[model samples]
Target: MARRLCGEGLGTMLLLAAIVGSGIMAERLAGGNDALALLGNTLPTGAMLAVLILIFAPVSGAHFNPAVSLCLALRGDFPWRLLIPYTAVQIAGAIAGAWIAHLMFELPVLQLSVTARTGSGQWIAEAVATFGLVLTILGASARRPDAVPFLVGLYIAAAYWFTASTSFANPAVTVARMLSDTFAGIRPIDAPAFIAAQLLGALAGLAASRLLFSPDAKPVAG
Candidate 1:
């Protein structure tokens, strides 16, 4: 249990660090080119996601996101008893990671984001983004467990471009980003809607996974 929680915390910490740190770095280097900065942020975040999942999945299922953990618990892939602990640690790790990123960039340890990312479209985008992410994780792990890391990475990379909200699919990630006044930050006032959307998407993804990859399906007779 301890090891699993540690894995969750560490994985989430590293994930946020990669996200916030990359955003800061990209903003500095993009030279007013939003596309270029986004591209830079996308590659590292996707790559780090794969690496982090590969490193931690064997130990703790690599659920760096509360949405993933919640969805897995709903799907019965994760033990219900560990859900709260996993979520708590993930949020803590995210906050710590944001602080780390700030320290690294020599910015304030905490700053409320002014970036207004609210509205119906962004909320809808969050729902869709999270649904796809959770679906990919659950679906891939059902048949090709070893492919989960890569599939999640690929899905997020694509979601970054396709989704208007930039795919803040994880509740923990969304909350943490509120403290960062960077290219990746979202306004605190907007987080509740995003989190609500993410939770809804997680439920939708779990339902979809159950329908698409029913665990009770019997094998065909020879």
Candidate 2:
């Protein structure tokens, strides 16, 4: 159990480090080109996610996102008793990751984001992003266990381009990004709505997957 927690904490920390660090780097290099910055941010984050998942999956299932952990718990794929501890560690690790990125970049170690990410479209996009993410996880694990890492990585890479909110599908990432005040940051005020949307989307995705992938579901006669 301790080992699992370690994996969760370390993986999430590294994941956020990659996200925030790459965002900072991209912003500096993009010279006001938001698209180029986003591209820079997207590739590193997606690549890191796949790599981290592969590294930590054997140790802790590589659940770097609280929303993913919560969804799996609800589906009976994770232990309910450990949920609180897992979430606490993930949040702590995520915040630490943000601070680590700041330190590496020589920015303020603590911050509250001023970037406002809000509104109906943004909320809807978050829901869709998380919904797809959870569904991708569930489906891939069900049908292609070995492909989970790459599938999730690819899905998030695609979601970054497709979603208006840029797919902040993880509550821990949302909170940590709120503290960065960087290119990847979300305003502190906006984090709650994004978290809410992510949770709702996770549940929706779980329900959808349950129905769609039900072993009891019979083939339709053609």
lDDT (C-alpha, whole model) for all candidates:
0.93, 0.94
- Where does candidate 2 have its weakest 10-residue lDDT segment? 212-221
Clashes of each: 0, 0
Score candidate 2 by lDDT.
Answer: 0.94
Which tens-of-lDDT digit does each residue in 57-114 have in candidate 1?
A: 8899899999998887877779999999999999999989988999999999979999
Total clashes, candidate 1? 0
lDDT per residue as tens, model 2, 143-168: 78899999999999999999999998
